[model samples]
Target: MEYTSRHTDGKRINTRSARRPCFLPGRIEGYGTKLQRDIDGKKTWNDFFFHVVAPPAMLDHGVWPDSPTGYRAANEEYCGHMMRLTRALFEHLSLGLGLEKGAMAEAFGGDELVFLQKINFYPPCPQPELTLGVAPHTDMSTLTVLVPNEVQGLQVFRDGHWYDVKHVPDALIVHIGDQIEASMNELEPN
Candidate 1:
């Protein structure tokens, strides 16, 4: 399907959840639709990635796509609102746990250090068991904001089971990584 990065975050970051009502953005009513363009315009899923995904400029960050700023700008635009809420959450996390109001902000230098957005497209497959669209990996940054194309693929490493991340329209996924967890140690305490 033709996946627009703009539409991706817009649709996925807003589902209501009983656990954390504030975790998601605001949901849009009756906006679900099928894939617009074929996953990668290939007759099948395997051919699609070989023909399209492997040759993309995004793969070769040094040569094919020389500009990193473009990626940054696109990410900021897509996740601006989520960033705001997250910042607020962090601020509260710091203070409620006995830190300064802007302590988290100051540690990162009073400005957002980095934000990255990844857009993935997975076409329908007869045997999804044979292959994976994107293999599992941990994000290198402090947090990861994800909006998967559909419901069946995404999973997270929790206590034990591979918990599926259900697509709740307009809801942003904010997962704190190891470093952020460490930073919060003094406050939350392991």
Candidate 2:
């Protein structure tokens, strides 16, 4: 079967139309389907992307593809590893803030925490300068851990300019999300 991206209405998603809510449980999102355009109606870098969202419960239940040889085993292993790493990172960050080691974890729903992983794929663009792979925006999760490909297209806005993020082998780049930033502000409100 062809693995094509389709919308909840059974319509194929493309780069032309605006985003709509995806009601299908395990649907793959099409390019630019989950992003808003700029003031000039220009699509973000998301136009070159497609992704699958897998919730923790879904992963636990093995609701993943199994026919692609070792794909199932590899995905499960990766998910388990990422979850452990997330837990460790939370504990360290909590301790660094002078709170109890499990404070962050507890605040984030603890053992029953719902983790969502988005596996994004960005294809090659004909005119790379015209569109972005993903728009510049802060992540909405409690924390985001990104394992980027070796293409080196990731950039970070700093000091009034965007800087390329260097890729390190076997390294994961973590970002504190809006929720954590809000919590930090509450901890030390100016």
Worst 10 residues of 2 by lDDT: 15-24
* CA shift of 113, model 1, Å: 1.6
lDDT of 1 by residue, 1-190 (tens): 1222333543322232233221124421112223222443322222111111121232322211223447434544545665676578668766876778877656653563443334344545555555455545576556565654447667887787788778777666777666566766544321
Give the total clashing residue pairs for model 1.
Answer: 13
Model 2 regions more than 4 Å off: 1-42, 45-63, 66-69, 185-190
Residues 1-190 of candidate 2: C-alpha lDDT, one tens digit per residue? 0134445573344433233323346554433343345534544534333333344443432234334568556766887888899999998988888878888888877887767666565544445666666767888888999987788778888899999999999888999998888777554211
Best by TM-score: 2
Best by lDDT: 2
Q: What is the lDDT of residue 150 in candidate 2?
A: 88
lDDT of each: 0.47, 0.63
Q: Return the lDDT, model 2, position 140.
A: 84
After the best TM-score superposition of candidate 1, give how far the Cα of residue 106 lies from its true spot, in angstroms.
2.3
